[model samples]
Target: MFKVCGYTCNRNDFLKKHMRLHSGERHYKCEVCGYACNQKCDFKRHMRTHSGERRYMCKICGKEFTGSDQLMKHLRIHTEERPYTCKVCGKSFYQSAHLKQHIKMHSGERPYMCEVCGKAFKRSGILKTHMRIHTGERPYECDVCGKAFKRSGILKTHMRIHTGERQYKCDVCGKTFISSCYLKTHMRIHTGDIPYKCDVCGKAFISSGDLKAHIRIHTGERPYKCDVCGKAFTQNSTLKAHTRIHTRESPFTCEVCGCACKQRGTLKKLMRLHTRERLYKCEVCGYALNQSGDLIDDMKTHSEEGLFMCGVYGKTFKQSGNLKKHMRTHTRERPYMCGVCGKAFPKSCNLKTHMRIHTGERPYKCEVCGFACNQSGSLKKHMVLHKGERPFKCEVCGYACYQSDELTDHMRSHAKEKLCEVCGKEFKLKGNLKTHMRIHTGEKPYKCDVCGYKCNQNGTMKIHMRLHTGERPYKCEVCGEAFKQSGNLTEHTKTHTEERPYMCEVCGHAFRQSCNLKTHMRIHTGERPYNCEVCSKAFAESQTLKAHMRIHTGDGPNKSEVRGYACKQSSDIQGRNRTNVTFAMKHSNMIPGSNT
Candidate 1:
């Protein structure tokens, strides 16, 4: 207790400090800064400015405080130590003055009354700031912007724009804030400390301002009302955003491209394109994306929720975009047409890749080997071979693959029970069965324009045209090997592995491929597939018939036509009458293995 002007006090030290108001004494002083104060406590607090000493500490939060009052206030948050209680309402508070204010609320007491307007306020600080409105007093001014504010705090906050200073920092997330109040508000997100409670639904909030706004929902109070449309909103920001519709004001603009947008988020997303900023990332595959929409689109690829399924192959996709792209395989729909050759592709990206054929553009280049590809994905997959990196692993088996499609294709090998109903033949994929059915139906959909030769498969037709054009696209890196198609490269790699996967069922003979086994099976079946058009003689094999043709053409190794044994046997076989016995003799001057 302290006393002044003939009032009694408990301690002489307190009386000495209390007399400073009348005596105007400056007894205690700082040694380093030469600053003086009337009381010892004030001088000691000022000395801390030079000493950088924080004596008080909070035990629960491990936060150090320079003053005992600050430590006491912070302790209430953890301990909920409210000592002051209102007598009228029996409400507890952390501070005695807050309890006094609570008692005034029940009594409807406003002791601080304005002299001019007779209006009242509870707090002296509020009344002082409010009196500035009538007095037109803006004492605080900014040094940088020359802006006047009612209080020094507002002036300090405004100075942050020029100074770029953030004094308060979040301890949890390391994010800095310009003001202590904003930092306090942000701490609630990490602490989940809701101090303000709504009386309507018992919903809690971290701030009193938020609780007041939430109460408007229950009361149906629209304080911020629109003038033009006669619409009401609880928040001022919502009203301001809604007014943009009537005003047609696009405030957010891109600095890079001069594009304007209504929302700030849209402008921010557009700016990322010029900056090439990839903020949002995929967790599953570490794929980086610029916008949240792009992240959402990429996340669907990793999801197991197959909303769309292919009817022909039974392949599933998580997104509708992927399923739509896959449907083009069955429909053979090539909507994206090339401008150079008028060749159509199923996807726009595929068309972009096709345009590179004419442009001779291979943008994606390998860093290790300098192998360039038109698509970026091809370059990424090709790099894995150099590193021997197989990231995609099968869950059923321990098999690994370089790409996601390789993993999908490998899964079919584990589930090999799927069979073709037409031929009762087993196939790893349903698409293989559909392709095999083409052989039975003799559906030569693919036709060649040069020689009018038709094939059941499009891939076979591409290989067939390579015979005429002499085009070999696939090349091996280990060996100087080149092939007309990718399947040839695959088969050529097996030479290095020495893997014999195919076997004959009749005999225990093993081969490197199924096609070789099919050729060997013809020996047991005695199936003569090749026939000579000149004499209608069926041969057991194409190579044998080609060799025997030399005897009829007088181009045989014997050179005497082997006494024309080939043509005489062909004419006598099957009891068929020859159109001309001298037909073989007339064609003796003809060349062997010639198109003519």
Candidate 2:
């Protein structure tokens, strides 16, 4: 046995070679490259590079190397045999040199230091790569795209783009990635491994890039900026998305509806409309949203205090934007206007939705019935029909509705009615009184593009357009019957329940709808509001007046059917020729209870 400097060897030649390190002597030297080594084998291996001789070859991959040890290390990659491992972390390495470098990480020793940035690395190659940042040197270049990278590994990964290759695959999800680093980062999603942590906040992130971005939030540092708007962002991706607004460039487009969006995140949110994917959910209300930002906004509804209050109505709102929008109602201000139709809206989102009418764009769709709509709220409300989920319920009437706004409107019915001073009419809502006043003013603001039909309310115009489009959005859950208007559906649904809420006071007669009871009251009161233009004959019911019109129009019922029908009153027709008189009543196209 031979030993020197606490190192021992069995062979005398190995001991003599080990002694050269203490003596500071290198016997074997390369004259061509000026490389020197104490070991004869290492010196011969270095000399092989000059001669272009790679004697050692891998059996599996046919890769050539100058030495046998180099070939052995290369073979481990194919075999996935990591012989060398660190004691501290138990991390295995293919080569002993890698294990040595990994041990330096455990020791907190970064020997290879960059002089320019004073940054340290465990390995010399990593330090060399770091130095390129200061020098702006990208040594490795791609042959296809001519893109340069600081490291050969990055250049190799970049080449995969041109090659259309995704070599690394996730074992769990089978998702492919270009590089092993990307695969490693993706594995964290399955593993739930948040290794990168912020020292200040103790918040952990899946990747180092996320951790770096999160750290900028604490520092209030926005490195990325838009040239057009001068708006700053924490992320470069956000800045690129912001730049598209100035360019009016919508790069991401929906494959299903062809709706173009400026940002990828916006496109993703739009895709959720087609997919019906609601990932982020509100814990308080169980309301789910596609995007995290929307979920965050919804969460505020539960916990947020009424910080902003309206001066005119004394209404309190959680957000300042809500307060601003509420003020528009009181002022009757429609600030947002459509470019195509010159239609004005109180909110910008309302204007955006109105533009879809001209564009004929309906992005939101129901998965069950193939019902499509321009608005997300419409799709959400439409989904309730299939699910039969009435989340919002009125306490007073026990009326269940899909939307909170519907429940709010129903609750107002129990409250004191808003009075119209001009006509002495009572309304459940203040908006109802305003709409009723339009009848007196003869102002019809909302007009249908399909037809020349006009109405005072926008909602009424929308329902009227359904006559042309044949869009029956409101459906009866009991009978599977559809109606163009929601009020018609509500009235139809009462037939299934056989629940008569409205009643006639005089005869104790019950009616399914309140409008039916109102028409019944006119019979006992002896009021004949509907009058004929030809003979000046008046009738209590609109149907009776409509039947009376057949006398002049020559489209009257058969003479034999109405022979005994000397109808003195509207109820008198019920006893005489009920079938023939009902036929004349149904045929009338004129407005009900109006002078025809």
Candidate 3:
């Protein structure tokens, strides 16, 4: 029952000296190695190299260590005991340090900071790697590839190529990889498992990398920047390819096609197209694809039915890309801007077609309908409507579709074998299951064709592609309001209808969708997921988070209310409506009376 102050005052100040040991404030130095350490134990460990001391030994493995902590970590291999446990998920770790790192998974605490880039990391090891940017120190080099890395571990892994070492082998497929982590990821293909999932969208991924990319959809963290255009990327590979544009370095030269690609993977895929090699074939549908990604996109035609619906006509699409394009008819997210007329569009393909108006290029022509289009795909879809030919039919359900891709998508709803092991979510197609598994594992496969924009879904990539090509197809029927897609038209129609379906339970406020409602609910609930790294201030949304971050940079408050208050004059009438005298009087009287 002794007070902390009473006990601290009575102590002989030994604790202060002990704290200096933990802080690593050097009072001692080794003349031989020029190593200075604060603690006696650290000095003792450093002296081991000079003395050649092998006092701490393991009887089982005959391994020697200079420190007690190293010996304790090594003993875990023999005992196989994981004492440290995470409170959030009940995950166990062999080391206390590992357990502490695992705790950050719940708390999201990033303690380590890099002075060069001002990037924060949860682990000190990551921060050390980040410091290399400022120092320009790449210690690890691959002898085979002549590639350099900042870390020694990465160099060791790269050396595996020269050694032809396949140290890690998949137990299920017998596939070999240089690293255990890669093998662990490959194992998920056989198991059909995805452990990681997005809490916002319910999308699953097979790996943490995929999850990180998906999180960018919510946070919009484009870390990798391009020197040429000041454009940013989420992945390193994307940034590498983008740098090639400035350098004009196309290392990947095709032997057959003679086409040069910045990325080796893209070149490899292009080589397959030249060879006419349909390596990946669907077992259920007998559909063949040259690339695995194309096969995945093809499979989505079947599995993603009733999920991605058109906001315009309540029609569901198998692919989110189609649905997103369809949403342009409603939201009027005409991001693609033309340099000519200052007009914008939603889809790049549509923008390309629009460009034809200026250029007078009609590439696609209909034989029966006598309508010509800039794109063949549009003409094909248009021809189906004219001919009434529903050739593509589902074998299981006998549902006929005009397009073969649409039929393939419909057939997936009938399939029952594919299932994600992590979330237990069922999918009709294996490719969809693979993509869905990415939601759990957090693997992002789709990349932007223009800007190397990597995303979990092709829809996001398509939206990103619009930044390069200006395309707006959907035009308002009443006011000649041009839009990018049909969905924008529908959403624009809502402006006329004034129909708000989404309503907040707490405040009874109506909104267009559940997302808007949820965002509004945060106002009352005071729940903010987005936070500023500089000041550690929480924000309800990413926009708010960005505005809050600006404050740390000596920027003014970005909130509309705060800006309005700052701009307001003392004599000006302030209320809901300035013109409505009675309404202004009512609101003005209530403002001082209410706590808000």
Task: Pick the lDDT winner.
Answer: 2
Measured by TM-score, the strongest candidate is: 2
Give the Cα-based TM-score of candidate 2 against the true structure. Answer: 0.44
TM value for model 1: 0.35
Q: Report model 3's TM-score to 2 decimal places.
A: 0.41
Q: Which of 2 and 3 is the better model by TM-score?
A: 2
lDDT of 3 by residue, 1-596 (tens): 12433324345555555556556678779999688977677888989978999788998999999988888888988999889988889998889999998888789899998876778999999898889888988977777678999988888888887798998987654658998888887676546477999998877778999888889878888998988799999887889998997898999899985667899889978987788877666655889877655655666666753357765688876667778888877887998887775678897866777888778778577777689888778897888888888888777778888887787777767665787799888877787777787777778889765667687877766666666777666777778887666666877877778889888887788987667788898899889888778777888888767655655675543223312332122233244224455444555655576434
Off by over 4 Å in 2: 1-57, 62-72, 79-92, 141-147, 191-203, 249-429, 432-596
Candidate 1, residue 168: how far the Cα is off, in Å: 18
Per-candidate TM vs. native?
0.35, 0.44, 0.41
Candidate 3 runs further than 4 Å off: 1-33, 36-150, 161-166, 169-176, 274-292, 295-307, 311-316, 326-337, 340-346, 349-596
Residues 1-596, candidate 1, lDDT per residue (tens digit)? 33446767788877767788688879887778688789777777777767889899888879987788878988898999888887777788998878887787888888898777888998787789888978999998887778899988889887886788998998865767788998998777556477999887776778888888889999999989999999999988789888987898988888886777777767878887888878666777998887644655666667655357889998887666789999988999999998887999899988888898889889778767899999888987998999999999999989998999989889988885677677788888888788898888888888999999998887888799999989888988779789998888988988888888898889989898888888789889988789887787888767778766766775534222323332334334323324333455456655463335
At residue 479, candidate 3 shows an lDDT of 81
Estimate, for each residue in 1-596, the C-alpha lDDT of model 2 and write its tens digit. Answer: 43445787788888888888889899988999798999888999998988999999888888899999889789889999999988998999998898998899879998988998788889888887888888999988999979898988888889997898999998865768899999999777556477998999676778889899989989999999888778899998888877886787998899998877888668878888899987665667889777654754565566645256799977777667889999999999999988876889999988888988889889788878999999998898889989989999887778899888888888988999998888899999898899999999999999877778889998888778888988998888877989998888888888888989999999999998888898889889987889999999888778778777876776634333444544444554565566866666666654485435
After superposing candidate 1 on the true structure, give the runs of residues whose Cα lies further than 4 Å from its correct spot: 1-335, 345-348, 467-542, 545-596
Steric clash pairs (candidate 1): none
